[model samples]
Target: MAGTEGIDITRRNKKPRLLTDAERDQLDEFVDSIHYSSRYNDDHYEYRHVQLPKAMLKKIPKEYFDGGRGTLKLLWEDEWRGLGITQSLGWEHYEVHEPEPHILLFK
Candidate 1:
């Protein structure tokens, strides 16, 4: 299938599964309740990120990335909608939603 005889050219990279309706709602609720005050918050810096379940992405065991970490990972809390990020930093918020199926939001 390729320059090599045994290579499976048909094989494709893993892709991210989209967020379910329920998950999306839950994330939104949290963003509103935690990131923003009922009235308004001028200090908030909202950022959106999509961290798919590990199973949805490629498994590079013992590797942070095949290459070096990028800006996205630096922002990626890998937690629930960036709650972990807030613990350390302020005025920053994010949402890590699952991408559309086969979309592969991350490398």
Candidate 2:
């Protein structure tokens, strides 16, 4: 059999692992650290811009953490709701803002 060289398949098609106790705690703490704020938009409509810090990257899998807006949103939507973040049906929901690689701003 011939050997295949330079064909790395590590972490390919891998699923996110369950967070450990410490990781869970870290995530919780970070979530708690986030502030809930509602500001008026240019149209004078009240909108929220919640910012998620990159601290989560410490424990969360990079595959999911850096997975773009929708992925990031899906990962934290539940937690955000628990923090009193309303949905678009009732009020204006937040939008994912990626101002920098280390920060996630949902405004």
Candidate 3:
């Protein structure tokens, strides 16, 4: 959340459908629990993500998932930057990975 000062990171979209207080709270909790790690794989660093709790899948709005299309954007310099929604290439750590209904992972 460091570079999100001017960005509305809580809401799922730029439309009028704002997040409910409870949803916002849940998102905040998820953000708080997020951890980022990098490991040297070959000559490059590979970022890794921790598997999130399954409960988060229910707490967040359905629109946030966007059928695997990212509802969230990357933040940089206090602004939402490019990196528009694209299909995952299977190696990206930030892709929302739900191997099962009970397993959720994101970066």
Candidate 4:
């Protein structure tokens, strides 16, 4: 969401994928329902997973998951994970728009 590939954040294990509006909405709802743990979750190779929902995970492409690597595995699957990774890596947020002149609503 914040960084272009390799600009501020590392590229995910799988190729970069863009989410559609509907997908983004669904992801938001799913994230709201889950209590995922990223840094202290089950080990995947040398890294940890965000501990995603099995049902939702099934719908995403298989390549998104690291195929059960014990350590150093990449668990990124959706927009949430991407956002997390970007933020955790200290990716700077770009300016969306310059602030316009302020308007007084009431006195």
State which candidate has the highest lDDT: 2
Residue 24 displacement in candidate 4 (angstroms) = 1.4
| Ranked by TM-score, top first | 2, 3, 4, 1
Tally clashing residue pairs in candidate 3: 0
Cα error of candidate 1 at position 86, Å: 15
lDDT score at residue 77, model 2, on the 0-100 scale: 39
User: What TM-score fits each model?
Assistant: 0.21, 0.42, 0.39, 0.37
lDDT of each: 0.28, 0.42, 0.37, 0.34
Error of 1 at 75 (Å): 10
Per-residue alpha-carbon lDDT of candidate 2 for residues 1-107, written as tens digits (9 for 90 to 100): 11123222231224334455665665666675555555545443434555545565454544444343423432333444543334443342233455543333332
- The window of 10 residues in a row where model 1 has the poorest summed lDDT is 98-107
> How much is 26 displaced in model 2, in angstroms?
3.2
- Per residue, candidate 1 scores C-alpha lDDT tens digits across 1-107 of 00123222222113322345554544443333332222232343332323343332332212222232221221222332322113333322221132332112211
Model 3 per-residue lDDT at 102: 26
Off by over 4 Å in 3: 1-21, 28-45, 68-93, 98-107
Residue 105 in candidate 2, Cα distance off native in Å: 6.0
Which ten residues in a row are the worst by lDDT in model 4? 98-107
**Cα-lDDT of candidate 4:** 0.34
